[model samples]
Target: MKQSGNSKQFAKKDGEACPRGRPREFDTDTVLTSASQVFWNHGYHATSIDDLCKATGLLRGSLYGVFGDKHGIMLAALDHYAEGSVARLAERLNAPVPAEEALRNALLHYARVACALTGERSCFITNTTLEMQPGDEELRTRVAAIQRRMATLLAASVIRGQASGAFNSTLDEKAVGDFLLCVMQGLRVLGRVAHKEDALIGIVDVAMRALV
Candidate 1:
């Protein structure tokens, strides 16, 4: 019998070939979250569809049916990560504390979390940027936009700090914001190599001093 393109064969418990059904009722959000964690741990180039399936507890057909492909799932995962991260940062920025102090605390929190993670250094977005291929123009563009948003938030905080006399007005707000982003990225890379949390915290502390 001729095999149909849409008719995929899956193995049953007893090892018999079964025709794949209408796909499983997997939650896309849950799957994306799981997939994001997997990518966070293993990174984009290192992570495979098999890894995503294992992480999400879904079969290959189900994963493909829901997410289309590895890139599709990764895009969804990136979106999920960006949303959560931006929200957390915004919350930190809006804290009742002084703007400079709040920004420092936020950076310290991020550094501590990055150092605490067992599997990778730095952030998934940062990791993806380093691993992105030339063909990944769209993904790179998205990453750039996220970075810009982060910079803008940091800049706004710096502006507020200047107004409140928390940070010195000598330094340009935009420059300080850009510097903080670079420092955070540097700390992420350093954390991947060094297990010492103090090293990461030191960077933030010094940056905080410079801001004040």
Candidate 2:
């Protein structure tokens, strides 16, 4: 029998504490990513300070020192998520292909991710929108801004489709973008319980018909 086993020492010990004597020395973006995941899995109100501290591997004091508070970290995480999502959307919507094709690619990408793994997670923004109270100004603004950006990006693609004669020219680009945005969000929500691929594909087809 061959004795081939990798050493477990290379892995950071699970209970290992953060290195002390170095303030703001850790990766901020990485912390935000970890913090975002905890918040995404559990809404802001439900997620405790201890939850974030454990997720980010930082002490409670350090977290407050760096991020001001839990809400601060949540905002940073939301910003990080929004920025990354918009960048990805721009890439997909701006692909060098027919507008309709690009839109299909984007929608398919969303569908694939939605159905991936357990498919229990929906978009963070969508979840936050429902969880946060309407009086939450900062949260509302961030989500609204992200939605607006998505609409604009999709509308740009719609315009291209119209110009290429691949999509209906008479349809309002912004309106179409809004419709597709709704479809995209709905698809994500529906994917949680839906296992069949064709069901989601059919939804895509129906949504695409608006453009055609």
Off by over 4 Å in 1: 1-23, 119-121
- What TM-score does each of the candidates earn? 0.83, 0.85
Local distance difference test, each candidate: 0.78, 0.78
Candidate 2, residues 71-122, lDDT tens digits: the string is 8889889998888889998999889887888899899887876777355357
Can you write out model 1's per-residue Cα lDDT over 85-135, one digit (the tens) per residue? 888888998799989779988899878877876536468888887788988
Candidate 1 versus the native: TM-score?
A: 0.83
